[model samples]
Target: MRILVTGVTGRLGQLVARRLLESGHELIGIDRRPWDDAPAGIEMHSVDLRKRAAEDVFRKSHPQVVVHMATVTHLIERSEERYRINLGGTRVVFENARACGAEHVIFVGRHTYYGAAADSPLYHKEEEPPMAMTAFPELADLVAADLYACTALWRYPELCTTVLRMVYTLGPTGQGTLATFIRGPHVPTVLGFDPLFHFMHEEDVAAAICLSIERRIRGVYNVSGPQPVPLSVLIRATGRTQVPLPELLFRAALGRFGLPRLPPGALTHIKFPIVVDSAAFRAATGFQHQIDEAGAMGEYRDAFPAL
Candidate 1:
């Protein structure tokens, strides 16, 4: 099968691209950043998804499978630019896919769209309406992007669309939300709160994406790996010192001592869990995580030892 993957330069994107290539599929990548060392035989196009050039790639390649994972997931970028890339870029990807007559489109999304709150269910289902925009305003664009991709399901019934809401990822790159939070010498936690953190090994995440494509699964699903573990256990597994700080102190201490400068609303996330049920995804794809929580944490620790 001919597959076109957006955000092919991203960590997760690279993993999925390589896996698909290994499976003997024709691979083409689109990303604003150049993959200078992209493996042989995988065609790569350095182009922004929101530009007409991106559409040209879709028209010329005429790929049968489209994997859209080009949205910004970090908070470091300007809000307006982030919104444009996350939401606007998503709109363009779907439009181009449909216009180009693609068979299946997969949108890789974050499970954080469920949001963290005292009232949230222990395990969120795919049908639950998104609440991340309400709890963390910074994530509004991401939620919108996910919802927009979901609309493709009914709006364009002829196109097989799969929306995957993936949990946090931990891997050797040490580049995701979970990695950054625990990368510093001292990992902070809200006082009297030990929320369960749900995450997956990067390899398993890539495998899940590949399985979805190979099986041509459709509809929205929550993708997770292993079981949920307390924040303290996760910190200990990563070989980092856990520092329990009051909510006020935690909020004030952002951007200091190697800590990430998160928005104020992110505090609620640390205090409450946002776990999801992946039974639907597993049933659909027969997906099982190859790496357990301990193994995933150990890989990160081996890649970047405690400071």
Candidate 2:
């Protein structure tokens, strides 16, 4: 299969493209920017979907499978710029994919789209309406990006769209709150609220993406890891001390310093737990990975020894 992958420079994108390439598929990768030591043999397209049309890449690759992995994880300083890159870019990717006659489009999204609240369901299904956008206005673009990919089916029924709603993904390249907290020396938590948490490994996520492409499965599916872990257990496993504090007091202190490390609007997730029911995807793909929380922390430690 000829596969065209967007955001090839991203860690997840690079890993997914590598797997597809190793499986003997023709690969074409694209990114707005380049990173050091790109994979060899795969053609890299230096195009920004937000700034210009991707028809050139779409026409040139002429892919049967289109993996849309490109995304803006961090909140860019400029509001309009962020919207263009995240939401606008997504619309363009699908537009070009359909234009090029691609058969399938694979999208990566977050489990948080279900919303994390006091009364939120412990395990979320794909049927739930997205509430995270309401909770976190900063995620509006991210949700919009997901909607753009899913709605492509209604707009173009011939295109098969796979929406993988991922939960707290952590990897050397992952920038999620879970990954960052694990890498830090100390973790701050709401005193008595140790919510259940689940994080997916980069390898596992890549494998699931590959499986979906191989099967050309359509519809939305939740992607997650084996078992759920508590916030306290996760911090202890990472060899980090938990600094329990009242939610209000902690927020006040964090505000003084602007929560320097975390991106704006992501602090809410640190307080709530959003777990997913990935059984549907697992049963269908039969996808499994060996990495667990212990391995995830080890990877972070190796990346930053001082932590």
Candidate 3:
């Protein structure tokens, strides 16, 4: 299948593109940032998603499958730029994909939609409803974009759409609140909270995505590592000292001193478990995480020796 991948410059994007290419799929990559060196034969287009030039990629690639990967996290301030890059980008991608008559459009989302309710389901199914938006304001744009992906299903019934939701993924180049949590030398946690977390390795995420596309699976699917680990276990495995603080005090200190911070909307996750059930995805695509609990901790330690 001829495929188009947006945000190919990102670590996850790069891996997904490489995986698809390895399977002999013709690939076209689009990213606003310039890539100095991309693998041979995969066409690269440098242009912002909200720009007119971005549409040319769809026209050029004539993609049968479009892997939409561009998303703005809390790293970008909560401003118009973030909204445009995320929400606008999704709107633009969907519009262009339909215009180009693309058959399948797969959106990569997160399992955080379930939120961090203390009593939330330990194993979340793909069909589980999202929270009522009590917290996670930093994720508003992301949630909006994710919901927008669903519109493609009914509005453009001819188009095939799938949402691949993964839990926190860790790898050498991965970044995000969860990634930053493990990056710090002193891992902080709520005094009495030890939430269960499922962190998939970068390679596993890429493989799951490739399988979804190869199998032409539709609907939403959650992906994660083999098992969920307690936040305490992860902290101990990383050899990082646990700095337990009152939840309120910790946020205040982080804000006042500009200390190492969790990615926006991550405070809730630290206090409550937020994990997804990956059985549906595995059954549908024959996908299973290649890394186990011990291997996951080892990979993380090897990547961040100082932590």
Order by TM-score, highest first: 1, 3, 2
- Each candidate: RMSD: 0.9, 2.2, 1.8
Per-residue lDDT value at 232 in model 1: 96
TM-score of every candidate: 0.98, 0.92, 0.94
Candidate 3 wrong stretches, greater than 4 Å: 255-259
Candidate 1 lDDT, tens digit per residue, 1-307? 9999999999999999999999999999999999999999789999989888999999999999999999898865448999999999999999999999999999999999999999999999999999887868989999999999999999999999999999999999887888887888788888999999999999999999999998899899999999989999999988899989888889888888777677877888899999999999999989989999999999999998997
lDDT of 2 by residue, 168-279 (tens): 7666673665675555566777777888888867788788889998877889999887687888887776566777778776666553332325444555676777899988
Model 3, range 1-307, lDDT digits (tens) per residue?
A: 8999999988888899889888999999999887778899689999998888989879877899999999876542467788788888998998999999899999988777677886787788877777725676777777788888877778888888998888887766636556676676777788898888888788888898898898998888888866888998887886666778898887766633334655556688878888788888888888878887767677777778752
Where does candidate 2 have its weakest 10-residue lDDT segment?
Answer: 255-264
Ranking by lDDT: 1, 3, 2
What overall lDDT, based on C-alpha atoms, would model 2 receive against the true structure?
A: 0.77
Measure candidate 2: CA RMSD. 2.2
Q: Which lDDT value does model 2 have at 45?
A: 79
Candidate 2 Cα outliers beyond 4 Å, as residue runs: 75-78, 173-175, 255-260, 263-267
Q: List residue ranges in candidate 1 displaced over 4 A.
A: none
**Top-TM-score structure, candidate number:** 1
